[model samples]
Target chain A: MARERKFSLNEVFQHTKQLLLEHGYEGFTFGLLAERLGVSRTAIYKHFENKEEVITAYMVDEMEQVFAKFVHIHDYPTFDEQFRFLLNLILYHDDLHRMIAIGRRIPDTTPAVRANKERLEQFHERMYEELNQLVERGKQEGRIKPHLPNRIVLAYIFQSVVVPHFPGISLDQWAESIKEIIMYGVMTGN
Target chain B: MARERKFSLNEVFQHTKQLLLEHGYEGFTFGLLAERLGVSRTAIYKHFENKEEVITAYMVDEMEQVFAKFVHIHDYPTFDEQFRFLLNLILYHDDLHRMIAIGRRIPDTTPAVRANKERLEQFHERMYEELNQLVERGKQEGRIKPHLPNRIVLAYIFQSVVVPHFPGISLDQWAESIKEIIMYGVMTGN
Candidate 1:
């Protein structure tokens, strides 16, 4: 009888994220992934044909997890509360933006890869649609400036995900400071 | 008699920037540069041994031009005036951020390239020093918030260089809006 080779999909995805973040798209490989998984290459091969398949799958999983939670933004009673919740969520998934950029560079070498890429793009559209509602709500409440284009406002908020971490600042402080800056900017008079 | 091959340093640097922007550092080539310059490959080889030397030389020229203007920030008198001047200058050189990032990836393979890279790094530090003075002045003037770290404030300003252009908006309007947002944020109450 052949020995059993057992590993959960969650474990595989955790390792995928780690490797992709550590090595980027170019450096990610099945050999390294298999080693990290503590399993034979055959066991890994049983699920995916190539690195692109694995990465795309990981991205899809990530998008699903993120958007699932993002759907609850409407649950917040006010635009201000919703804005804070959104920023906090975005900050929590700090690596998502980098991951999405990496995903764009992944070639559609196979049908499976192509399909996963399409799914990721759909998730992206859904995300922007969700954010747009928040922008609309802010406008309705007269919180956001009227003349500002919606896209610029969205770009500013999205750009916050890339703000460099400062030493001696806690994550909560960083998020709060960024939220304050986004809402009122650096001017003390504001 | 051999034909003369003549091209100015300015012309060469212009083509260098164009090619670097189009193909990135990895795809940049003397062959392509010669094609763009309408000169023989030997003409380029006559000036620099490799692509790295030419690129580093071009980057050094760019830094000199930018910093020459940056030095005059002190002439603005007030912190508000100085801040506006700095943002306008930065917005004008929109590609500078991308060029500087490409410069960082250039390997120090030769002595000439190594020297040029060091010069670029010094220019970068000098730039931060200049910006730091502006930040301090703003704080002293009670314009910028006191508790915020200097780096975050600087990062926010620098990141504006990457903001996507909105269709149908004039550059003047765009710059003014960005300056307004940076100072007072998107909040109407401010």
Candidate 2:
């Protein structure tokens, strides 16, 4: 029978994510999670098989939320705004760092990570296409520079500061700084 | 007495570094290391108190090689040439991705890692100071931009690409495209 606990699945997940953020992957023990949630260790197992399962669930859920933000980015007016969004999305967001860390640390020898890489790469490629289109639109609208190749610039910015370790820096701040550098290099008419 | 091994210390170290590169900190075993080096595990113990010691030694050796290059950078005669030398020192010649992966995977809560981080941070600071000097000199020579702060630009580049993931891309040529991006971004004339 399902542990007729006081907590719901989403509630447990939310709590687990908080723990993962407060503590890291290793610190999220079943005992502490159970104690923190005012439930037995068995209750956690009822919802998830292992710590790996819970951590994986949390990371993927976070990734989905980040992807959701990317999907809705076009809602912003102006390529300059969208450009700001792209640079920020790569730099300060916790989701990007978490995902990239997961990608790098997890052994690719495993079938599990290899399979996961497919979805991850697909998501990245789609996002790149969206960003490329945004820059293209900016150029046509006389906002971004026309001469720089779409993919090259995208990869340049992406690789430059994508997996940021600095937590306090804001997206607008980083975007503005990089925009000045790129502004000197590229023509993004303010 | 030290084991009269057929292989030299250099040979043993080469094997150890290779094993760490392929398998990572977790995957590497004392038994496996001995087996690859064609020595008894006891002999290995004589050389390194633990695997961590070996890894630490490897890093120290690697940094020494990089530092040796730094001394000769003045020979290059142009800031761009010097930039290329610095780039190769940090990104090209090192198995840096492995070190980065190892660094990220270890939580600061771990006692060993916490202690290791102090030394690592000091090393990073020294390198950063030297790099800032290089960039500043480049600016004076009109080879690198004056507008960007060396701390932000060099730190970002070092963190992003100079660093590496264990068992990931180890080839220097792999970073050619990234070097191109950074070259353009930091160039004064751009």
Candidate 3:
């Protein structure tokens, strides 16, 4: 008789992320996941009790990867360069943007969901702290406005990542346009 | 015997919009809609063939209302005033934003769905045309940058409407911050 294959935790997370991105929360199912993983339903259930657990695990992993990218922001010489790098990273990672946009809609009633939410919050808090540091640096370096609230600035920066892409525009052009619009107001003072 | 109550088309559209905003597309169903409207499922089916039809109809109605608001943009003296007015209107109308965000996920294989999509496209085209005119006016008035494409400016404006609200900040503050960030940017020259 042929032996059944075993899957690793990393393998499970990779497939789960793909499934969530492809099907969204509503269409994802443990049965479909098991089938995709080439394993029996019981085999997959042995690892995760329910769909929420898998989803939470996937999000945690993805968030960690994203957080790691922020560590290198300081490596850039100027705040403008750092900001542009961050913007390009976010624009290219469409899956991550979609995941963040839809993350709030995930039902979080269970303990696992609560844990996931807490971890996500921590990541956000850390991100905001890093962002604050950058804004302070920008202010000192004469790159950021002094009077604007840090929170509002952060919101605008984060929001730019999710800006809708126009049809027929190349990604490079879109990125450049977005950077210009954000860095300089649309208004052209005569 | 007393006469039975009959729901009008407008009533159906209003209730459908409410359900969509409350439960999102996944939770919306004809059975639930009928129960909320005090009508049988058969009665709902008599007017709309499926959930897509109901959603498309609701979107069409809502889009028409939003489009109608653009007519008076010229009433404002300056493009800046008109821009702020439009921004505030979009920010306040949370339901419309939610509907537009969720509208893309609706499946549209049926003829009814296709028809609804066409109508929506027409409304979008009209709105874009109006926005372009505003952009031209802004350029002539020296408010908007002369070099920026109209589409990029429009994308930036629309994206601001859906910017995530920060915790603990009042809506008024958020709006002011966004306007300032968009108008003057985060950089300081001094």
Candidate 4:
């Protein structure tokens, strides 16, 4: 009967994200998570050993979701279409960048968390590989300059998310502006 | 007389920067600083009450130096020329960005450090003012797109320094490439 409880990993991750965003890694606690989820601390403990386990699990889950969407970039045709799709995708997952940073600081004291961290690192490497392929595609199509290094081009694209959101702008407009800046820069093109 | 001491603020700040970069703000201590400077802790204490005071003072001094040079952006006539000058200066003072971040984390426990922190903040505001002026000039001269918001353009330029240094590339080349990317972007413009 205890195994048939409503304790779901999806619900747990939803609260985990909220607490992590609000309190950060150091401030996050199982007690706080339980309160937010409207469940007993024991319910959470039943699923995970500690806060690190929950956080690591949440981060891995987020990464997997992002990776799933990223692999779909091939569905979009042309370099510009793919680039726009990528810019929108990155902007949508803006919070994940902060979470990724927090993930790096998680201690590897527990075997579960350590294994999750290793898996997260592999996902990170694969993401970079995906980006590399995107750059290669752009170069092959002659959309990007031939002389520019793939790393620099890739870095420029990744840094776009760090640009803070300006007031009075919707997300679509913001992503469109960044796409324009990334492709043609601020020049008038005279 | 006691006035005839080898301890100089210039030497102190130079070593402070090195130590902060090496060990970060938390790892830095007066003992390590004194040992590296070949001076007694008492000698250093004569000039500073604590580590916070030293770090804050060094940060203010660095900001002032950068500000002094930044005011000369008007020396260059063209918009692109001024932009390039600003880019190189920002890149040259790249370590200052990390130091500025460390400066923010210093506790405001002393009057001297607190005063320095305020002054450092003023310098930060003035730097942004300078950047805003640069963007205004570009727009007025019809070089940069008038449709682009100044904040996005400025953020894009500032974020350029965060790009990792690719191996085998000199600083001059790196700055040049970034300048190109900022002005023309990676597109071939065909």
Best by TM-score: 3
Model 1 DockQ vs. reference: 0.44
Error of 4 at B106 (Å): 5.9
Cα-based lDDT at residue B170, candidate 2: 43
Q: Candidates sorted by DockQ, descending order?
A: 3, 1, 4, 2
Cα deviation of A79 in candidate 4 (Å)? 2.3
> Using alpha carbons, what is the TM-score of model 4?
0.78
lDDT of 1 by residue, B1-190 (tens): 7665589899999999999877667768899999998889888888898999999999999999999999898898888889989989988898888787678768888899999999999999989998998899899989999887788888777777766677887777777777778778887873
lDDT of 1 by residue, A1-190 (tens): 8666577788889999998767656668788998998888777888898889999998999999999898898798988889888988887888887687678778888899999999999999988987888888888899998887777778777767767677887777777777778888888873
Q: Per-prediction RMSD in angstroms?
A: 4.1, 5.8, 3.4, 4.5
TM-score (0 to 1) of chain B for each candidate: 0.94, 0.70, 0.82, 0.91
Ranking by lDDT: 1, 4, 3, 2
Clashes of each: 0, 4, 2, 0
Docking class of 2: incorrect
Q: Which stretches of candidate 3 lie over 4 Å from their true place?
A: A1-15, A34-43, A140-142, B1-15, B34-43, B94-97
Per-residue lDDT of candidate 4, residues A80-112 (tens digit): 888878878887887877687578778887899
Give the alpha carbon lDDT tens digit for every residue of A1-190 in model 3: 7555588778888888888766667668898888888888888777677888888878888899888876888789877789777777666665775677657777776788879978987997888898888888878788887777777777677777666777788777778877777777676634
- Candidate 1 CAPRI grade: acceptable
Q: Measured by TM-score, how close is model 3 to the native structure?
A: 0.85
Which digits, one per residue and each the tens of the lDDT, describe model 3 over residues B57-114?
Answer: 8899888888777677778987788888777766666466567767777888689888
TM-score of each: 0.81, 0.70, 0.85, 0.78
Instruction: Kindly report the docking quality category of candidate 4.
Output: acceptable
